[model samples]
Target: MSTTNEAALSLAGVDKIYALNSRKPVHAVQALDLDVRKGEIVALLGSSGCGKTSTLRMIAGFESVTRGSITLAGRRIETLAPARRGVAMAFEGYSLYPPLTVRDNIAFALKSARINATEVDKAVKEMAALVEIESILDRYPTSISGGQQQRASLARALVRPADLYLLDEPMGQLEPRLRALLRGRLKRLLNERGMTSIFVTHDQTEANALADRVAVMEGGVLQQMANQTELKERPANLYVATFIGEPPMNVFDAKVEIGERVRFIVKDGPALDFSATAFSQAARVAIARRARAVIGVRPHDIRLGAGDNAAKVVSNQWLGDQSHLALDVAGKLMVAVAFDQVNASRGEIMRYEVSSTKLHVFDADSGEAVSHGAEAA
Candidate 1:
């Protein structure tokens, strides 16, 4: 395990296992390694049952680490009590005191530290304004909407000074518009304060918009961790490529054919030819060995009008600024996003071109990206 001298939070080979009653132990987290720098925000991103919440719980000391270690500011903290670690957490459940007004709720943490009345008042006011809940300051938790309650909880977490902050689905209860609004505000606030923070969310938009880096997790395992640009342009594997995109990348089984120009033929669908120099040595070797491979392309990377691959439009959905076209190519379903008006209708056969410059080749068996645009020369 590597030690980060200045990391605000570090997890080295961390594991969380639940010993069941008369059954096998469940490994909820497995040998996870991650580092978050001081004053940097990193998002723990993945789908449900991916161990994101379990990892957060372990960090907060609500769950025990079965093995390995966690450190905060160079101090080992996996064994520390939740409060002893100086970390503030806001959860999806508001966890607000129902009898208390918003102001009192936000002031609770500060008051617990025996801060003076004047200081508490000033801090509470600033936090309410920051979370844009000043108008609801005097309202009891039970009387306010879920969004309002979430803001109050967030403010409570933010009002107190702490070495680190953890927010688990803080905006999960809000409507889309409200979530977007709070996401922007929360991101800017965290940046301005320079608070070391970890945001746990399943929403990709939330992760991409807010965090400096994102750690993608899967069933009890860390898949990949990288900045948004790296994840998009150079995904570590097929799962990252498929899971990180909005509409998701289109992937289909393909065979590489040796020719003057290497050709990729999608099973029963389409074929694209790339110059020999366009392929990397690894890809060339894979092709020569007849290793199973797949071709992936983002929807926006497919050109609508002309190519060797002919597809029939299954459906077209007009979404204002753009349209989504569901196409059937040789009985396989494929999708493309058209920015301009598409002149085809359902059942209309059309020839389409894929941006050969933007192709992603993956080893079918291992599901890892082998090359980009066949590693363009």
Candidate 2:
């Protein structure tokens, strides 16, 4: 789906294997494929051991790829050394030299590249200002706080221009407030400078805030890659639908009947009539199978006292801007968001409805999106 000629970085059929002593080789990454376009920030997002770090390491040339190729600016570089690949990397471990001051750390790459002293100094100052570490340029690595050290590492990686930039959880160690601040600043800086960047992060907030596109990975395989809107509103599968949102999407198994009126029958719960809603042909065919299917709806899509579903309030939590209601529909627990202040008590029966367009249909057995609906949802 990406043009190699226009890409800043591309990976095809990439794999990484770790050998054990008389044991099966662990496949850390498998048949991974990705393309990061020029002047865009793409986030590699997944939980721990999901191979995000391994993928970044492979691209950076710190780890060798067992198979496949990596390309930077239309040139193959999987087998190239890190230095020859012309990629800058900032690590979570803050791999700064202990003896070097923050200013010197940032200037090292430029100096090594034979850039003049005045130019290197100017570049260091500019990078430090961009990362908000200019005041601490003289501090040693051991003298600064964890957050400062992270900024220093980022400054060093971004000080010199390169074909690509790889950042491994660069903000994972920072406080929440600082992380939020830096996310905005980093995104602005990258966009303004027209830099191509790939950052690995397990935090969905970080991905949503900073990335132009997000590649979601699980068990060494890429599940989906799309902009935040698509990933949230039209997930490729159940993993992505549930994985990308805060409070997550609520999905429940049900039996669908495509008779005179389309209906969803919850096991032991009330049946829901969706006859008024028009479904896709594929969705109709999938429903005709009458097999087990799941219905996914975002918390905001479930409205109280509005439609064809009923649930008992299990708990009510009042967040500042909204409220979270935990409901028990038959034997299953469902979460719904209420925009207004709610004073409903536990055990109270609440009637709710799901918006027709916001519904996500998936095959219950495979956990794959049956409809793969449009973005307006």
Among the numbered candidates, top TM-score falls to 2
Look at candidate 2 and tell me the lDDT of residue 365.
79
Local distance difference test scores for all models: 0.85, 0.86
lDDT of 1 by residue, 130-179 (tens): 77899999989999998889889999999999988999888887888878
| Candidate 2: tens digits of C-alpha lDDT, residues 45-78 | 9999999999999999999899999999888999
For model 2, the run of ten residues with the poorest summed lDDT: 368-377
Model 1 sits at a Cα RMSD from the real structure of 2.9
List runs of model 1 lying over 4 Å from the truth.
1-5, 20-22, 286-290
TM-score each candidate: 0.94, 0.95
Q: Worst 10-residue stretch by lDDT in candidate 1? A: 1-10
Give candidate 2's whole-model lDDT: 0.86
